[model samples]
Target: MIEPDSSGDRPSGSAPETTGRFIVVFAETEADPPAFLRSAAGLSNVADSRDFGHGPVDPATAGDADATVFASLGVAVVTADPQQAGALRMSSDQSNIESISPELVHHALSQGTLSPPSALFQDTEHFTWGLQATGAATSPRTGKGIRLAVLDTGFDSSHSDFAGRQVTVESFIPGEDPQDGHGHGTHCIGTSCGPRSSREGPGYGVASEADIYAGKVLSNSGSGSDGGIIAGIEWALVNGCAVISMSLGADIAQVHPPYTAIGRRVLDQGSLIIAAAGNNADRRQNDFGFVGAPANSPFILAVGALDEQLDLAYFSARTLPVRGGQVDIAGPGYRVHSSWLMPDRYNTISGTSMATPHVAGIAALWAEATGYRGRELWSVLVQESSRLQAPSVDVGSGLAMAPQE
Candidate 1:
């Protein structure tokens, strides 16, 4: 069920407007989107609109027989003249046209200091201490049949480690290929769905055998608009991905309506969306920043970062329930090592970004082990987590753990 935005009028503290002049309009689940969109006086076709499996509805017949065509989908991205953006918002009834939010920019959550790979232990087959802490090392489940989607900068498809693996790549960022030019996506993917072994060392992946859906939402510059990320989410859902991992976000105090809707929709569809809790905290100085947008939506699982000693990372944001953002769990993030784009092959980075994929990969393992999906899967993750001494606001239920065989 779509919850009403409790803040009444759209808050100014929500996601910043995108540089691009466009607004995403979401229709009611029972409304005829084509007809409704066509009725909007200023609505225009966005260049290169692809049919995302709803069988393209004709604008002419949208009000008639095809009125209900987009009823089930409940979402649409439309472009309007910049001068008419406000009028478009005013026209929405907050029902059939549920929301009209400006597409906002999202960035990779890897803004922390890079550390030497040696900072992480190398004794295990997987260089990441996260994999071991989450029990992925000994868990019987390999996430063989599960499909996990990672929406980020993209992946290093040419990497030898993932050669011959089942990877489906797509780029929502215009003029960019689904390849990891910025290296952030590759490292995140390496942690969540990478292989079991590589020439560099033991495989640092979690759901090693899981099918990978690498969606390039962010660009080479490591930033993306909310439109691209939403498109990627739609693609992942349409493709039947069991878990969608987002290691990217924007720091917004108010919960974005689109994400709240999307998160609820995904949960209803039996898939889980996990996102980073943001890396804005400086605990040493008593600065525990708030979680970011998307993750700020209560429906999405927000993950925080923990160090090797199980202490909250200095940069891991804490949950502020009053602000509607809360951490759901924690994962090893400090000085974590994982796959990087070739030539470099591997890198050690730290952030809530790194911790998110650990939960995602572990979620895949739990899904494979228990056959749980959606909200049930989410509960399993929380219920089965290894409790830590940390506060719930900082580390959620506890450290996210892999399901035991």
Candidate 2:
């Protein structure tokens, strides 16, 4: 059953969707997860990631393996019976174990349609309103040396604007290719890494020269399980992406357990994950929705949506009264123009989904200009953002800005 958002239209504020499989987070110092799982949980059909040599793991490739261990993040996604799962959860051997959780189902954070906003910063012959509003249009940095990861529904490799760019594509979803079936990933990729000079309209991308790592974590239908998303993160880390942009999330207010550890671990490795704060609000109806899982993890940066006028988007979620649930930054998301799938080629959409990649692209620019990574990169974004008059719960440190020099 899909729970309705404040607008009584979109799904939000429900118990998070979950897959029956369990996620096991091992202690960071655990040396051999394959042996630990065998001795503690008494199962042996495990696929160790060290065998795959640090690339994205396709779940289908695991075949009959009962558990798949991501060695870098020290986590495993296990297909266990209730007895087996309960044993791992309730085990007295707590030395090597951290947390066990049901894998969650996440969706693309788009509103699925466009809503006309009162015009403020209009698109010009050279730039989209988002690029103009965030100062990305005039910023000198092109993120030339940075590597950015966009983990979502996938990317459109056939898009004309990206003809000569370097892009690495991988799919973590079983039975799906990395080619984008849903337009969300393509749109996000355009916002973050599309070309600076385009035959289409104005330039909509932020970090034009950054290497693109498109990881298809969500299925074509716009939903994904935690295992696939985690796999994407591992892939991004292994590939040395300086920033990871996640425009997908579960609409649960509570912080998800796995991401707390995963987020912290990824940052320590010098990569930052930036996620949409969520599109569950309806301010016209006076319901300011809370930030959702993955985004709500303290170690990950949460971004809310703002319009060309620099006010919070009506659908952009408000900060939940939790440590990591607060919106850390804002970006132009309402009716933002960016790349889409072929034939259509371009789209104008609204959501925190659109806002996330703007900050991500800007993050790449900062990564290039300042040579900052992980926590330092996160700090630079917060410290350099333009402060707005709205409450911090709605806009955080205000809008994310591009580096001028």
Candidate 3:
């Protein structure tokens, strides 16, 4: 029942081009990735190859018979010869090549219409309502000793609130540093891994003591390619991050093969990838659209947005269950406040993008409290969430909550 978008028009503000000339070729579980590549080189031109963990293979000796077999996550990003690429796809170990597809683009899911702080009652930090609603405020566990990765634009390393925090950062965006120029990443990080409190406001963060691994997959302009995102995922897995939160996505109706594969692989490796369900819905207009790519994949946890009243946010996307993009959970997103780049260190924004980190931060707490990882951790989150009146199509298991312990 999952149908592809017939309208060729790309989502608004999305990058027009796909991930450049390179193509991603995934090796099947039983096949040896490096061995398969070496054998294929005899029939087709294999330029450069990169295996997870071992890094990039030398182009000159890529075809060496003794090449180490890529056993874990067995994926490779290769530059194929234009003439034989087609034949290679056809002849490549049909059993081993799980999928051959063009790398697509991904974007930060933040919507416009930034609201002023005064929109919510000023006496209390209404932005932190998400924390209170999820029981993160009272959770005895602080997500200590856990590594949580937020893959997005980047983090504002200069933010005073995180001055002494254990934050490790890496940038996948070409020619860009990890410093957050776009506020979206900073905001998401603020919610997931920020401290107890800041000078600008009360604590709006969830897993305050969790170690933060900010992976900048999107650039300052708030856009990036699938290659960058895949690389970021690999990095997170290599570093043993227990939870990977992605607040960025593209409005594609169909599931992307790469993300599906990556999501499964990450889960198998004991890491959970959480993504926004996107902010493309407008119930007032009666346009409840499908969840976006990456998130649409059944393996990734897709989250929807709610408002201060715990009602579904007007813009929160609902899953087309027939299409496999069901909302897995919900969190406060409308006019939510969080840290921004310095000088103006705080701002309020809305989107499923904002809601995703709330689940992530709470996931960290659950992980720390229950010692659960990967799919087990995912199950605990859904089982422990506060069920709301909303349909599963709109809010899945309902609002994600922090562990009571």
Candidate 4:
């Protein structure tokens, strides 16, 4: 493992302070890392970060070449700003994509770029749940102002409802800015704390007033590595986030090792984590079984998915590690409506990914009321969940309708 540079003196604090320096990796760029980082902005440290193989891999390097960068800089922990992440769209999704005008694109694109209104993101249904007289009881505490860290694709800062809200965007994929390329992240956030957008029951949001932290760990394609996720979780844990909505997952046996340590760290640091049980409902496994992992992390509240009809999705993974202490809750997942890539459209995409946010949105309400710590927030939510009558494997808690809606 690459070690932290013993040569540099870091400020002596229990926590590692984030340095302004950030590394950018891509198939392009032949310039030296030191020059690139210094040119991007005034950074104190920089190094040749990871080589994803797709990039220019200089074969002539010495021993301990690329991997040593992060362990040394200590700045390995640095974050990607909006100006740094600029979004990367899929090729077909790129043909029509072009540099936007108004000069603002300079700032928005350098880190992450939004699709031109006609590109692809069509805003869909609003995903908030804290309407006073809606699904849950009209309680005084339903997450009015707590902050939640959304670690997925970035959000639609251009959306009107998000107006006046404070958002800090970061990226893991180089050249990927905060502008969400895939509508998945937008939908996920809309479910958690989106504000009133349109009428027809599409404008009202859940936990509408809470602050949001945009941690873009997944790419616009709705995929990310366990390493990137771990790093993103670290950012959320130390950045004043009370609740974290991670609407994605990998199988119990498929995930990388770093995931175990990072998942545990996020929880130990007092952050409530909500993750999807995965959409891989086995074609072979009998019905009533939908447990998946990392989501199965005991400290994490693993959420299962149910369709619009209130029935579980066929593709939703069957719950396992059940007797072994895995799986936790279930929520509405199929055809759920939320934000999209287009500036004006919104749509409901199916998956346990959709279900995970409902729990997160609900956690926001709990935090607003009890000021519950991460663990406490999750505890209250689980205690109030509506479970399946038979205690089957597919639907963990049967149904997860928050008390406060």
Candidate 5:
């Protein structure tokens, strides 16, 4: 669901008729508990009731059967203009019922993250990376010279685990890095560029020795859109990141312009932009019937997801990814462990969100080894990636083999 401003207006212009957003609505009877109504009704403040596209089921059937209800409603749903869409819009007769974006939702990501023990992943086996694909029993490159920028909600710089790691952080959204309040950014950073030292806690991160920048584009709830993402990319470039890892996705545009321009600049300036293929593989990333936008751009290394045991993941998108000569890669997404915000708990998060960082880390290691920059590192990355044996249009360059092996 999308949120409207306080006047119940959209962020910019009127919500486009093809606004590409949706909300669920339903009504409750007196017999139903008021608490449930509070939760469901709360959606009104952010999204506004008039914009709710479908449904008016009983509170009893609405809570657990929302999906079934939506399916029954079918494709004949009606969305509203943001200006007219504020809060609940009940009729005087109690015949009409609707829901809107929850007032408390504040952001997009549905769940808060759990924290990984800095000590638990102290060894290779329990860690996120033990060196990839280079054929060593362990990884050799520490990623000391690499600079990785994480574009997500925000980061928790105050954690002892991140003591000296943060260089700079800018919020495209209205928030602060110290407010890694959402936890997505924290986990993302831990994936690509967390420190390698044992004293830094045991959340096994990939480029343990690389410097980092936090580019907060998404809100604490993981909420974001194409605009913020583009802004984050520009910010990352200005900050001088060697690798900008985006563990997020956006709706693909039917039209294209300048998407390649920013990234090409990053690439030309010797930086790599690694992005998620998108979790919407099931929903369809766009009208082209495949991967999300920006990922479609030529300069990025788009990554798909895989399960921890190296199997193709359920969430990974299927696409014949090729931009110029660049063939994207895949990596572990599900059951792949990493740090969360809640202390002592490791998050088994999945999605291209989790997978993109693995590629960023490998590229960092490669940059460390070859002193390669710009398209040079990007070329090595594509060439060195594990090629698919029975590669499908869905699975790209097979899986990203453990970079250091």
Candidate 6:
């Protein structure tokens, strides 16, 4: 495990945080990945996903294994020395190995600063501003049969409002349980899958009836590496989650290779992965930051933040000129209200992080309403979105909306 670093700052041209380990992506035609690894790189202490039967891979139990292969994703997180990494790269030309890249460290993309807009939609006795802005307030579809996964800093399993909901929890962070220590995950859950009828506050969640799959990919300190994140993604895929929401990313302008492959594979498997465009922008100062890391992957849908007036959030990233760095959609994110830890009960924060779940939840509603998965779901979202005065580079197709019928 690396040291706790809460300050999410990586200078423009600086190298990103990496684990020194490498991720290996195998081609679909690879007959025996483990055997190939053994022959090519002489790696033996490998744990295969098939060993777990129907359950998810336990990172703790497989600690001793040098390489843990996720069968569903055709990916492996391998720990190797310089010699082994070089050998694997050389073998990729003749072997089924497609790409080898260093594993990156990712952090939760929550905004550090808060600035609520003065005018437009506000929370009422019935619904939060997010719901009103996205038309989730009147959407008949409740994501009834959809399985939505929130891969973040765990979740508050005991959160009161979600008592009777069908919530399945898992922790990819080795030492931690599924319970959320950082409130980001819980707040996101409240927005994406919290109950429709609340005991205290307005209905903050969008897909109130969607089954919740809380995967603790990030640790309690709100940081994690690519290995754990990949494990969580594999778990969600194995369990047939149609929509996966990631509110975390690394502050790298270049498109991360692993996420690019992962996003394409996830979409191919009939799932959609929605991620937050990093809160690195300060538009007030004309410092429009570009989308970063996983969100910059071409296959994954990147989301930007919008205030109540449907204006772009100051901290929301502007699109990069690169292929997949553009914001594909927008969501209510400024000073959004949602569930928090116990005693506090609720909290309102702002970020592209908050915007992600809004799109994810609304994706669930659309998934339930149209029976669409993967790319089809992505198309419907862009097609059904409400166009705004904001440029396409910033807001993409505009604010994503829930299926109203």
lDDT of 3 by residue, 1-405 (tens): 111331223456853544433333454554545546667644343333344335665545654422223344454545445443554466444665665544455678778665432322221543377777778777887789999999999999999889889999999999999999999999999999886566667788899999999999999999899999999999999999999999988988888888888999999999999999998899889988778988889889999998877788988888956455899999888787789989889888999999999999999999999999999999999999988777789999998988886
The true-versus-predicted C-alpha distance at residue 335 of model 3, in Å, is 1.3
The residue-level lDDT of candidate 6 at 191 comes to 93
TM-score of 1: 0.69
Off by over 4 Å in 2: 1-119
* Candidate 2: residue 215 lDDT (0-100): 99
lDDT by residue (310-360, candidate 1, tens digit) is 788999999967545889999888888888989888899999999999999
Against the reference, the lDDT scores of all candidates come to 0.80, 0.90, 0.80, 0.60, 0.60, 0.90
- After superposition, the stretches of candidate 6 with alpha carbons farther than 4 Å from their true spots are 1-119
Q: Cα RMSDs of all predictions? A: 24.6, 25.4, 24.5, 26.8, 24.9, 25.3
TM-scores for every predicted model:
0.69, 0.71, 0.69, 0.62, 0.61, 0.71
The TM-score that candidate 3 achieves is: 0.69
lDDT of candidate 6 over 131-219, digit per residue (tens)? 99898999998999999999999899778898889999999998899999999999999999987668797899999999999999998
List the candidate 4 regions with Cα displacement exceeding 4 Å: 1-142, 252-257, 282-290, 322-325, 390-392
Q: Residue-wise lDDT of candidate 2 within 163-265, one digit each (tens)?
A: 8899999999999999999999999999999976678799999999999999999999999989999999999999999999999888998999999999999
